[model samples]
Target: MGLISEVLLLPLAPVRGSAWAIRQALREAERLYYDPAAVRTELARLEEQLEAGEITEEEFDQREDELLDRLEEALRRRGATGEGTAL
Candidate 1:
């Protein structure tokens, strides 16, 4: 099964995180959605967690999806920045 598909086989997961990591990941993910390197890093981490049974595949998938979605939104936001407009 795929990552998302495998995630669907499990019950809802509960995760705990530091506020710092959450904010940092969110910021990084915005520009990193389609970046293969970023995706690979996250995927490797998720895969390791799953392999260790620290997190289920479903949890990994959900997190991955969230990151991707955030990235897409970020790109849209970035695109909306018109030419040479100072923020």
Candidate 2:
């Protein structure tokens, strides 16, 4: 941008910086959401909850399906990007 543009936009620098920080945080959150290891840990926790009588069989099945779906998605994403561990 030209010097005049930069000078005019200087007042919005903090807003720009805040937006960048929010984007970065969301990116990391999404990475973790699609992480295979994290999904596995969640699966284990769900099993424990079921065994401990904290959840019903129906609930367990539903949540298990969701977790497995996430695992599949994570695996697919990994395969597509050729990054991270595979299922």
Candidate 3:
């Protein structure tokens, strides 16, 4: 039965493989996006941009808020998953 089912499903292998690859890529992207260190680095860069007058105070405030939200979320996720103790 197992052999028969596998043979029947063989034609869908490419679709399954593609779906799996897409899921893996999305997971990796999410991990990077939520990484605490990367978020901090981005926050620092945003501050520098403000100091350089590349961005207005309003823009800095908005971006800083977004980065803080990301950092908070990352810490929350880490706590939930017991992945690490540090943010």
Candidate 4:
């Protein structure tokens, strides 16, 4: 049965492979986006930019809020998944 199914589905191999690749890419992207260390690094860079006058206070506030939110979400996700305590 397995051999017969594989033979029948051989024509769809390319589609299946593409779908798998897409899924893997998405997973990797999500991992990086939700990484706590990466979020913190971005936050630090944002602070540096503010201190250097590269960004206005308003802009800094807005971007800082977004980064904090991402950090909160990452921690929450880690807690939910029992990945250990927050950093």
Candidate number achieving the greatest TM-score relative to the actual structure: 3
- Arrange candidates by TM-score, descending: 3, 4, 2, 1
TM-score of every candidate relative to the true structure: 0.39, 0.89, 0.94, 0.90
TM-score of 3: 0.94
Residue-wise C-alpha lDDT for candidate 2, range 7-43, written one tens digit per residue: 9999999999999999999999989999999999999
User: Model 1 over residues 1-87: C-alpha lDDT tens digits?
Assistant: 699875885453333345567888998865566454565577678778888999977898998787677555545565676422222
RMSD (Å) per prediction: 19.1, 1.4, 1.2, 1.3
Query: Where does the lowest 10-residue lDDT sum fall in candidate 3?
Result: 78-87
Q: Compared with the true structure, what per-residue lDDT tens digits does model 3 show for residues 6-85? A: 99999999999999999999999999999999999999999999999999999999999999999999988888999984
Deviation of model 2 at 4, angstroms: 1.2
In candidate 3 the C-alpha lDDT for residue 56 amounts to: 100
Better of 2 and 4 by lDDT: 2
Candidate 4 local lDDT, 1-87, one digit each (tens): 599999999999999999999999999998899899999999999999999999999999999999999999889888999998646
Candidate 4 segments exceeding 4 Å error: none
Q: After superposition, how far is residue 86 of candidate 4 from its true place, in Å?
A: 3.5
lDDT by candidate, in order shown: 0.65, 0.94, 0.94, 0.93
Model 3 lDDT, residue 7, Cα: 100
